[model samples]
Target: MHGTETIPVRRVRDGALDLLKWLALLSMVLDHLRYVGLSLDGLYVPGRLAFPWFCLAIAANLQRVRGAPVTGQWRYLGWLLLFSVISEVPYRLFIEDADTLNVLPTLALGLLVARGWQQKTLFDRGLALIALLLAALFSSNLMFGFFGVLLPLAMLLVFSRPWYFSVLPGLVCVAANQWQVLLDSGNLVALLGLATCLIAPLAGRVLLRYAQGASPPAMRRWAYALYPLHFLLLLLVRQIIA
Candidate 1:
Protein backbone atom coordinates (compact mmCIF):
# COMPACT_ATOMS: atom_id res chain seq x y z
CA MET A 1 0.00 0.00 0.00
CA HIS A 2 2.88 2.33 0.85
CA GLY A 3 0.29 4.63 2.44
CA THR A 4 -0.57 6.81 -0.55
CA GLU A 5 -3.97 7.75 0.94
CA THR A 6 -5.76 7.57 -2.40
CA ILE A 7 -8.24 4.72 -2.40
CA PRO A 8 -11.30 5.08 -0.25
CA VAL A 9 -11.01 3.88 3.29
CA ARG A 10 -14.82 3.76 3.34
CA ARG A 11 -16.51 4.92 0.15
CA VAL A 12 -18.50 2.79 -2.24
CA ARG A 13 -18.09 2.87 -6.03
CA ASP A 14 -20.17 5.61 -7.53
CA GLY A 15 -22.08 4.64 -10.66
CA ALA A 16 -21.95 8.24 -11.72
CA LEU A 17 -18.18 8.27 -11.78
CA ASP A 18 -18.06 5.13 -13.86
CA LEU A 19 -20.56 6.62 -16.26
CA LEU A 20 -18.38 9.67 -16.64
CA LYS A 21 -15.41 7.45 -17.43
CA TRP A 22 -17.41 5.48 -19.96
CA LEU A 23 -18.37 8.69 -21.68
CA ALA A 24 -14.79 9.92 -21.62
CA LEU A 25 -13.55 6.68 -23.15
CA LEU A 26 -16.19 6.86 -25.82
CA SER A 27 -15.17 10.41 -26.66
CA MET A 28 -11.55 9.34 -26.84
CA VAL A 29 -12.36 6.55 -29.26
CA LEU A 30 -14.35 8.97 -31.38
CA ASP A 31 -11.40 11.31 -31.40
CA HIS A 32 -9.00 8.56 -32.45
CA LEU A 33 -11.35 7.40 -35.14
CA ARG A 34 -9.97 10.31 -37.14
CA TYR A 35 -6.90 8.18 -37.80
CA VAL A 36 -8.88 5.47 -39.55
CA GLY A 37 -8.28 6.91 -42.99
CA LEU A 38 -11.53 8.79 -42.88
CA SER A 39 -12.40 12.46 -43.07
CA LEU A 40 -13.54 12.73 -39.50
CA ASP A 41 -11.99 16.00 -38.57
CA GLY A 42 -15.38 16.76 -37.11
CA LEU A 43 -14.66 14.15 -34.51
CA TYR A 44 -12.04 16.53 -33.21
CA VAL A 45 -14.63 18.63 -31.43
CA PRO A 46 -16.18 15.75 -29.51
CA GLY A 47 -12.75 14.36 -28.94
CA ARG A 48 -12.10 17.57 -27.10
CA LEU A 49 -14.40 16.17 -24.46
CA ALA A 50 -12.12 13.24 -23.73
CA PHE A 51 -9.19 14.87 -21.94
CA PRO A 52 -11.17 17.32 -19.89
CA TRP A 53 -13.66 14.68 -18.90
CA PHE A 54 -10.84 12.41 -17.91
CA CYS A 55 -9.39 15.18 -15.80
CA LEU A 56 -12.74 15.58 -14.17
CA ALA A 57 -12.74 11.89 -13.39
CA ILE A 58 -9.44 12.26 -11.64
CA ALA A 59 -10.74 15.26 -9.77
CA ALA A 60 -13.91 13.47 -8.83
CA ASN A 61 -11.94 10.49 -7.64
CA LEU A 62 -9.78 12.71 -5.48
CA GLN A 63 -12.85 14.33 -4.00
CA ARG A 64 -14.35 10.91 -3.37
CA VAL A 65 -11.30 9.85 -1.42
CA ARG A 66 -11.07 12.83 0.84
CA GLY A 67 -10.96 12.04 4.58
CA ALA A 68 -10.02 8.40 3.96
CA PRO A 69 -7.00 7.41 5.98
CA VAL A 70 -4.10 5.28 4.69
CA THR A 71 -5.12 4.55 1.13
CA GLY A 72 -3.89 2.47 -1.78
CA GLN A 73 -2.91 5.64 -3.57
CA TRP A 74 0.38 4.06 -4.52
CA ARG A 75 -1.43 1.31 -6.39
CA TYR A 76 -3.45 3.81 -8.36
CA LEU A 77 -0.31 5.63 -9.41
CA GLY A 78 1.38 2.32 -10.15
CA TRP A 79 -1.32 1.34 -12.63
CA LEU A 80 -1.14 4.72 -14.35
CA LEU A 81 2.65 4.64 -14.64
CA LEU A 82 2.55 1.10 -15.91
CA PHE A 83 0.11 1.95 -18.66
CA SER A 84 1.95 5.14 -19.46
CA VAL A 85 4.83 2.92 -20.52
CA ILE A 86 2.80 0.10 -22.03
CA SER A 87 0.66 2.35 -24.17
CA GLU A 88 3.55 4.30 -25.71
CA VAL A 89 4.38 1.85 -28.47
CA PRO A 90 0.88 1.63 -29.86
CA TYR A 91 0.35 5.35 -29.39
CA ARG A 92 3.37 6.28 -31.45
CA LEU A 93 2.49 3.78 -34.13
CA PHE A 94 -1.05 5.14 -34.42
CA ILE A 95 -0.39 8.87 -34.32
CA GLU A 96 1.97 9.84 -37.09
CA ASP A 97 5.10 11.63 -35.96
CA ALA A 98 3.80 12.05 -32.45
CA ASP A 99 6.02 14.62 -30.77
CA THR A 100 4.86 13.90 -27.27
CA LEU A 101 4.38 10.78 -25.23
CA ASN A 102 0.87 9.34 -24.86
CA VAL A 103 -1.82 10.84 -22.64
CA LEU A 104 -1.32 8.44 -19.73
CA PRO A 105 1.81 10.22 -18.59
CA THR A 106 -0.04 13.51 -18.47
CA LEU A 107 -2.86 11.83 -16.54
CA ALA A 108 -0.35 10.19 -14.21
CA LEU A 109 1.34 13.46 -13.43
CA GLY A 110 -1.99 15.20 -13.08
CA LEU A 111 -3.07 12.52 -10.62
CA LEU A 112 -0.04 13.36 -8.52
CA VAL A 113 -0.96 17.02 -8.41
CA ALA A 114 -4.66 16.47 -7.84
CA ARG A 115 -4.09 13.84 -5.19
CA GLY A 116 -1.47 16.04 -3.61
CA TRP A 117 -4.02 18.79 -3.34
CA GLN A 118 -6.48 16.41 -1.71
CA GLN A 119 -4.09 14.52 0.55
CA LYS A 120 -1.95 17.46 1.80
CA THR A 121 0.62 15.25 3.52
CA LEU A 122 4.30 16.18 3.33
CA PHE A 123 5.29 13.29 1.06
CA ASP A 124 2.30 13.70 -1.23
CA ARG A 125 2.78 17.47 -1.32
CA GLY A 126 6.47 17.10 -2.10
CA LEU A 127 5.67 14.62 -4.83
CA ALA A 128 3.15 17.05 -6.21
CA LEU A 129 5.76 19.79 -6.38
CA ILE A 130 8.13 17.47 -8.19
CA ALA A 131 5.36 16.51 -10.56
CA LEU A 132 4.69 20.19 -11.30
CA LEU A 133 8.36 20.87 -11.85
CA LEU A 134 8.61 17.91 -14.18
CA ALA A 135 5.46 18.94 -16.02
CA ALA A 136 6.87 22.46 -16.53
CA LEU A 137 10.26 21.15 -17.61
CA PHE A 138 8.86 18.53 -19.95
CA SER A 139 5.67 20.14 -21.19
CA SER A 140 6.73 19.74 -24.79
CA ASN A 141 7.29 16.04 -24.40
CA LEU A 142 3.92 15.59 -22.77
CA MET A 143 0.89 14.90 -24.97
CA PHE A 144 -1.19 17.79 -23.62
CA GLY A 145 1.67 20.00 -22.37
CA PHE A 146 1.87 22.00 -19.14
CA PHE A 147 -1.72 23.17 -19.24
CA GLY A 148 -3.01 19.62 -19.28
CA VAL A 149 -0.88 18.82 -16.26
CA LEU A 150 -2.65 21.56 -14.35
CA LEU A 151 -6.16 20.59 -15.45
CA PRO A 152 -6.96 17.99 -12.79
CA LEU A 153 -6.13 20.55 -10.13
CA ALA A 154 -8.17 23.15 -11.96
CA MET A 155 -11.02 20.68 -12.04
CA LEU A 156 -10.59 19.92 -8.36
CA LEU A 157 -10.74 23.59 -7.53
CA VAL A 158 -14.04 24.04 -9.34
CA PHE A 159 -15.74 20.68 -8.74
CA SER A 160 -17.80 21.78 -5.76
CA ARG A 161 -18.52 25.28 -7.11
CA PRO A 162 -21.28 26.61 -9.31
CA TRP A 163 -21.66 25.24 -12.84
CA TYR A 164 -20.49 28.47 -14.44
CA PHE A 165 -17.23 28.15 -12.55
CA SER A 166 -16.27 25.30 -14.89
CA VAL A 167 -14.89 27.90 -17.28
CA LEU A 168 -11.69 27.86 -15.26
CA PRO A 169 -10.81 24.33 -16.35
CA GLY A 170 -12.40 25.03 -19.71
CA LEU A 171 -9.71 27.54 -20.49
CA VAL A 172 -7.11 25.03 -19.39
CA CYS A 173 -8.64 22.41 -21.70
CA VAL A 174 -8.50 24.75 -24.70
CA ALA A 175 -4.90 25.58 -23.98
CA ALA A 176 -4.07 21.89 -23.80
CA ASN A 177 -5.73 21.32 -27.17
CA GLN A 178 -3.86 24.28 -28.69
CA TRP A 179 -6.30 24.64 -31.57
CA GLN A 180 -6.20 28.33 -32.38
CA VAL A 181 -5.16 27.56 -35.98
CA LEU A 182 -8.08 25.17 -36.34
CA LEU A 183 -10.37 27.81 -34.90
CA ASP A 184 -9.15 30.25 -37.56
CA SER A 185 -10.18 27.83 -40.32
CA GLY A 186 -13.91 28.48 -39.90
CA ASN A 187 -14.58 24.80 -39.32
CA LEU A 188 -17.87 24.39 -37.51
CA VAL A 189 -16.48 21.31 -35.84
CA ALA A 190 -13.56 23.30 -34.58
CA LEU A 191 -15.92 25.89 -33.19
CA LEU A 192 -18.00 23.17 -31.61
CA GLY A 193 -14.86 21.69 -30.16
CA LEU A 194 -14.24 25.00 -28.46
CA ALA A 195 -17.74 24.98 -27.05
CA THR A 196 -17.41 21.39 -25.92
CA CYS A 197 -14.18 22.08 -24.09
CA LEU A 198 -15.78 25.02 -22.41
CA ILE A 199 -18.77 23.05 -21.16
CA ALA A 200 -17.35 19.57 -20.61
CA PRO A 201 -16.66 20.09 -16.93
CA LEU A 202 -20.14 21.44 -16.38
CA ALA A 203 -21.65 18.50 -18.19
CA GLY A 204 -19.61 16.01 -16.21
CA ARG A 205 -20.39 17.63 -12.90
CA VAL A 206 -24.08 17.59 -13.69
CA LEU A 207 -23.91 13.96 -14.68
CA LEU A 208 -22.35 12.95 -11.38
CA ARG A 209 -24.62 15.05 -9.24
CA TYR A 210 -27.92 14.07 -10.85
CA ALA A 211 -27.26 10.67 -12.38
CA GLN A 212 -26.07 8.78 -9.35
CA GLY A 213 -28.63 6.05 -10.00
CA ALA A 214 -27.74 5.49 -13.65
CA SER A 215 -26.16 2.09 -12.92
CA PRO A 216 -23.37 2.17 -15.49
CA PRO A 217 -20.85 -0.63 -15.38
CA ALA A 218 -17.91 0.26 -13.21
CA MET A 219 -14.78 1.19 -15.13
CA ARG A 220 -12.17 -0.62 -13.14
CA ARG A 221 -8.41 -0.57 -13.61
CA TRP A 222 -8.60 -3.06 -16.45
CA ALA A 223 -10.14 -0.27 -18.45
CA TYR A 224 -6.68 1.22 -18.65
CA ALA A 225 -5.77 -1.43 -21.20
CA LEU A 226 -8.47 -0.06 -23.49
CA TYR A 227 -6.42 3.01 -24.33
CA PRO A 228 -3.75 0.98 -26.13
CA LEU A 229 -6.13 -1.64 -27.43
CA HIS A 230 -8.25 0.97 -29.19
CA PHE A 231 -5.26 2.34 -31.05
CA LEU A 232 -4.41 -1.08 -32.39
CA LEU A 233 -8.03 -1.66 -33.35
CA LEU A 234 -8.08 1.62 -35.22
CA LEU A 235 -4.90 0.71 -37.02
CA LEU A 236 -6.55 -2.51 -38.08
CA VAL A 237 -9.53 -0.55 -39.30
CA ARG A 238 -7.24 1.67 -41.34
CA GLN A 239 -5.64 -1.37 -42.89
CA ILE A 240 -9.00 -2.89 -43.71
CA ILE A 241 -10.19 0.29 -45.33
CA ALA A 242 -6.93 0.76 -47.19
Candidate 2:
Protein backbone atom coordinates (compact mmCIF):
# COMPACT_ATOMS: atom_id res chain seq x y z
CA MET A 1 0.00 0.00 0.00
CA HIS A 2 2.86 2.39 0.77
CA GLY A 3 4.44 1.73 -2.60
CA THR A 4 1.08 2.00 -4.33
CA GLU A 5 0.26 5.22 -2.57
CA THR A 6 3.57 6.77 -3.61
CA ILE A 7 2.79 5.97 -7.21
CA PRO A 8 -0.21 8.28 -7.27
CA VAL A 9 1.78 11.16 -5.81
CA ARG A 10 4.50 10.63 -8.33
CA ARG A 11 1.97 10.52 -11.13
CA VAL A 12 0.43 13.76 -10.03
CA ARG A 13 3.80 15.55 -10.03
CA ASP A 14 4.90 14.17 -13.36
CA GLY A 15 1.50 14.88 -14.89
CA ALA A 16 1.59 18.46 -13.72
CA LEU A 17 5.12 18.94 -14.97
CA ASP A 18 4.18 17.57 -18.35
CA LEU A 19 1.10 19.76 -18.49
CA LEU A 20 3.05 22.93 -17.68
CA LYS A 21 5.73 21.94 -20.16
CA TRP A 22 3.24 21.44 -22.95
CA LEU A 23 1.64 24.79 -22.16
CA ALA A 24 5.02 26.52 -22.23
CA LEU A 25 5.78 24.86 -25.53
CA LEU A 26 2.49 26.01 -26.98
CA SER A 27 3.14 29.57 -25.86
CA MET A 28 6.56 29.41 -27.43
CA VAL A 29 5.04 28.12 -30.66
CA LEU A 30 2.54 30.96 -30.72
CA ASP A 31 5.35 33.40 -30.10
CA HIS A 32 7.32 31.90 -32.93
CA LEU A 33 4.24 31.87 -35.09
CA ARG A 34 4.67 35.59 -35.29
CA TYR A 35 7.92 34.96 -37.12
CA VAL A 36 6.14 32.80 -39.67
CA GLY A 37 2.55 33.83 -40.28
CA LEU A 38 1.03 36.63 -38.25
CA SER A 39 3.78 39.02 -37.12
CA LEU A 40 1.43 40.41 -34.57
CA ASP A 41 3.31 43.23 -32.88
CA GLY A 42 2.39 41.78 -29.51
CA LEU A 43 3.48 38.25 -30.33
CA TYR A 44 6.33 38.48 -27.87
CA VAL A 45 3.81 38.69 -25.06
CA PRO A 46 2.84 35.05 -24.93
CA GLY A 47 6.33 34.02 -25.98
CA ARG A 48 7.41 35.16 -22.53
CA LEU A 49 5.88 31.94 -21.24
CA ALA A 50 8.67 29.74 -22.59
CA PHE A 51 11.71 30.60 -20.50
CA PRO A 52 10.17 31.01 -17.06
CA TRP A 53 8.12 27.86 -17.42
CA PHE A 54 11.24 25.96 -18.36
CA CYS A 55 13.01 27.43 -15.34
CA LEU A 56 10.27 26.39 -12.97
CA ALA A 57 10.42 22.88 -14.38
CA ILE A 58 14.11 22.74 -13.61
CA ALA A 59 13.54 23.93 -10.06
CA ALA A 60 10.83 21.35 -9.58
CA ASN A 61 13.21 18.62 -10.64
CA LEU A 62 15.81 19.88 -8.24
CA GLN A 63 13.31 19.82 -5.43
CA ARG A 64 12.39 16.24 -6.30
CA VAL A 65 16.05 15.25 -6.27
CA ARG A 66 16.78 16.99 -3.00
CA GLY A 67 17.25 13.88 -0.92
CA ALA A 68 17.99 11.37 -3.66
CA PRO A 69 21.46 9.97 -4.09
CA VAL A 70 23.47 12.55 -6.02
CA THR A 71 25.85 10.14 -7.72
CA GLY A 72 24.23 10.12 -11.15
CA GLN A 73 22.86 13.65 -11.31
CA TRP A 74 25.45 14.56 -13.88
CA ARG A 75 23.70 12.25 -16.28
CA TYR A 76 20.99 14.84 -16.69
CA LEU A 77 23.62 17.39 -17.63
CA GLY A 78 25.02 14.97 -20.19
CA TRP A 79 21.65 14.59 -21.89
CA LEU A 80 21.27 18.34 -22.05
CA LEU A 81 24.68 18.69 -23.70
CA LEU A 82 23.76 16.08 -26.29
CA PHE A 83 20.59 17.94 -27.26
CA SER A 84 22.21 21.36 -27.25
CA VAL A 85 24.48 20.19 -30.04
CA ILE A 86 21.56 18.66 -31.90
CA SER A 87 19.44 21.80 -31.54
CA GLU A 88 21.97 24.54 -32.37
CA VAL A 89 22.17 24.53 -36.14
CA PRO A 90 18.47 24.05 -36.71
CA TYR A 91 17.78 26.86 -34.27
CA ARG A 92 20.18 29.19 -36.04
CA LEU A 93 18.67 28.36 -39.41
CA PHE A 94 15.10 28.91 -38.25
CA ILE A 95 15.30 32.34 -36.64
CA GLU A 96 16.35 35.31 -38.69
CA ASP A 97 19.21 37.26 -37.09
CA ALA A 98 19.24 34.76 -34.23
CA ASP A 99 22.39 34.54 -32.13
CA THR A 100 24.77 31.62 -32.44
CA LEU A 101 24.14 29.86 -29.13
CA ASN A 102 20.63 28.51 -28.58
CA VAL A 103 18.39 28.18 -25.54
CA LEU A 104 19.51 24.64 -24.72
CA PRO A 105 23.06 25.78 -24.12
CA THR A 106 21.85 28.29 -21.60
CA LEU A 107 19.58 25.72 -20.04
CA ALA A 108 22.47 23.27 -19.95
CA LEU A 109 24.68 25.74 -18.17
CA GLY A 110 21.87 26.80 -15.86
CA LEU A 111 21.42 23.21 -14.79
CA LEU A 112 25.06 23.03 -13.86
CA VAL A 113 24.76 26.15 -11.74
CA ALA A 114 21.74 24.84 -9.91
CA ARG A 115 23.22 21.41 -9.31
CA GLY A 116 26.52 22.89 -8.21
CA TRP A 117 24.83 25.11 -5.66
CA GLN A 118 23.02 22.07 -4.34
CA GLN A 119 26.05 19.83 -3.95
CA LYS A 120 28.53 22.50 -2.93
CA THR A 121 31.04 20.58 -5.00
CA LEU A 122 34.31 22.14 -6.07
CA PHE A 123 34.12 20.90 -9.64
CA ASP A 124 30.61 22.20 -10.14
CA ARG A 125 31.62 25.50 -8.57
CA GLY A 126 34.41 25.93 -11.10
CA LEU A 127 32.14 24.91 -13.91
CA ALA A 128 29.49 27.35 -12.82
CA LEU A 129 32.06 30.18 -12.88
CA ILE A 130 33.17 29.30 -16.38
CA ALA A 131 29.56 29.07 -17.54
CA LEU A 132 28.77 32.52 -16.18
CA LEU A 133 31.78 34.06 -17.93
CA LEU A 134 30.88 32.46 -21.23
CA ALA A 135 27.29 33.61 -20.90
CA ALA A 136 28.42 37.22 -20.34
CA LEU A 137 30.72 37.22 -23.34
CA PHE A 138 28.13 35.66 -25.60
CA SER A 139 25.22 37.74 -24.31
CA SER A 140 24.91 40.10 -27.27
CA ASN A 141 24.77 37.43 -29.93
CA LEU A 142 22.84 34.85 -27.90
CA MET A 143 19.98 37.30 -27.31
CA PHE A 144 19.44 36.91 -23.55
CA GLY A 145 21.15 33.56 -23.39
CA PHE A 146 23.06 34.74 -20.33
CA PHE A 147 19.85 35.73 -18.67
CA GLY A 148 18.59 32.26 -19.42
CA VAL A 149 21.52 30.83 -17.50
CA LEU A 150 20.65 32.94 -14.51
CA LEU A 151 17.01 31.93 -14.70
CA PRO A 152 17.35 28.51 -13.09
CA LEU A 153 19.19 30.01 -10.18
CA ALA A 154 16.44 32.57 -9.90
CA MET A 155 13.86 29.82 -9.86
CA LEU A 156 15.76 27.91 -7.22
CA LEU A 157 15.84 31.00 -5.05
CA VAL A 158 12.13 31.62 -5.33
CA PHE A 159 11.33 27.97 -4.80
CA SER A 160 13.45 27.88 -1.70
CA ARG A 161 11.81 30.94 -0.14
CA PRO A 162 8.36 32.27 0.63
CA TRP A 163 5.96 34.11 -1.68
CA TYR A 164 6.98 37.54 -0.49
CA PHE A 165 10.57 36.80 -1.47
CA SER A 166 9.49 36.26 -5.09
CA VAL A 167 10.26 39.92 -5.70
CA LEU A 168 13.92 39.01 -6.12
CA PRO A 169 13.49 36.80 -9.18
CA GLY A 170 10.77 39.13 -10.44
CA LEU A 171 13.26 41.99 -10.59
CA VAL A 172 15.88 39.89 -12.34
CA CYS A 173 13.39 38.59 -14.86
CA VAL A 174 12.22 42.13 -15.61
CA ALA A 175 15.74 43.48 -15.98
CA ALA A 176 16.65 40.60 -18.25
CA ASN A 177 13.57 41.33 -20.34
CA GLN A 178 15.51 44.42 -21.38
CA TRP A 179 12.75 46.96 -21.08
CA GLN A 180 15.20 49.81 -21.56
CA VAL A 181 16.57 48.20 -24.67
CA LEU A 182 13.11 47.70 -26.09
CA LEU A 183 12.29 51.35 -25.48
CA ASP A 184 14.00 52.20 -28.73
CA SER A 185 11.66 50.07 -30.85
CA GLY A 186 8.79 52.06 -29.27
CA ASN A 187 6.75 48.87 -29.46
CA LEU A 188 4.42 47.90 -26.65
CA VAL A 189 5.51 44.26 -26.94
CA ALA A 190 8.43 44.92 -24.60
CA LEU A 191 6.10 46.07 -21.88
CA LEU A 192 4.02 42.97 -22.42
CA GLY A 193 7.10 40.80 -22.02
CA LEU A 194 7.85 42.54 -18.74
CA ALA A 195 4.36 41.91 -17.41
CA THR A 196 4.42 38.25 -18.37
CA CYS A 197 7.75 37.60 -16.68
CA LEU A 198 6.44 39.19 -13.49
CA ILE A 199 3.13 37.39 -13.35
CA ALA A 200 3.98 34.03 -14.90
CA PRO A 201 6.00 32.75 -11.92
CA LEU A 202 3.15 33.34 -9.53
CA ALA A 203 0.96 31.16 -11.68
CA GLY A 204 3.86 28.77 -12.15
CA ARG A 205 4.14 28.09 -8.41
CA VAL A 206 0.56 26.95 -8.29
CA LEU A 207 1.00 24.79 -11.36
CA LEU A 208 4.10 23.20 -9.84
CA ARG A 209 2.15 21.97 -6.83
CA TYR A 210 0.56 19.25 -8.88
CA ALA A 211 3.77 18.03 -10.57
CA GLN A 212 4.12 14.87 -8.46
CA GLY A 213 4.03 11.42 -10.14
CA ALA A 214 5.77 8.65 -12.00
CA SER A 215 8.65 9.46 -14.30
CA PRO A 216 7.46 11.53 -17.22
CA PRO A 217 9.60 9.42 -19.50
CA ALA A 218 7.64 9.95 -22.68
CA MET A 219 7.25 13.67 -22.22
CA ARG A 220 10.79 14.10 -20.94
CA ARG A 221 12.29 12.12 -23.79
CA TRP A 222 10.38 14.02 -26.44
CA ALA A 223 10.73 17.53 -25.07
CA TYR A 224 14.40 18.06 -25.89
CA ALA A 225 13.88 16.92 -29.46
CA LEU A 226 10.95 19.26 -29.82
CA TYR A 227 13.09 22.31 -29.13
CA PRO A 228 14.95 22.16 -32.42
CA LEU A 229 12.31 20.29 -34.35
CA HIS A 230 9.69 22.97 -33.75
CA PHE A 231 11.99 25.69 -34.99
CA LEU A 232 12.77 23.83 -38.19
CA LEU A 233 9.10 23.02 -38.77
CA LEU A 234 8.11 26.64 -38.28
CA LEU A 235 10.84 27.74 -40.65
CA LEU A 236 9.50 25.41 -43.30
CA VAL A 237 6.02 26.79 -42.87
CA ARG A 238 7.27 30.35 -43.12
CA GLN A 239 9.18 29.62 -46.33
CA ILE A 240 6.24 27.90 -47.97
CA ILE A 241 3.90 30.77 -47.08
CA ALA A 242 6.37 33.35 -48.27
lDDT of 1 at 207: 91
Tens-digit lDDT track of model 1 for 56-107 = 9989887876776635667778999999999999998899779999999999
After TM-score superposition, what is the CA distance of residue 15 in candidate 2 from its true location, in Å? 2.0
Q: How large is the C-alpha RMSD of every model relative to the true structure?
A: 4.8, 3.9
Q: What are the TM-scores, per candidate, against the unseen true structure?
A: 0.92, 0.85
Q: Which stretches of candidate 2 lie over 4 Å from their true place?
A: 1-13, 184-186, 210-218
lDDT of 2 by residue, 110-208 (tens): 888787787677987888888888878887655456777787888887796777776666666666677677656666777677878887776777776
lDDT of each: 0.89, 0.76
Judge candidate 2 at residue 111 and give its lDDT: 81
Model 1 segments more than 4 A misplaced: 1-11
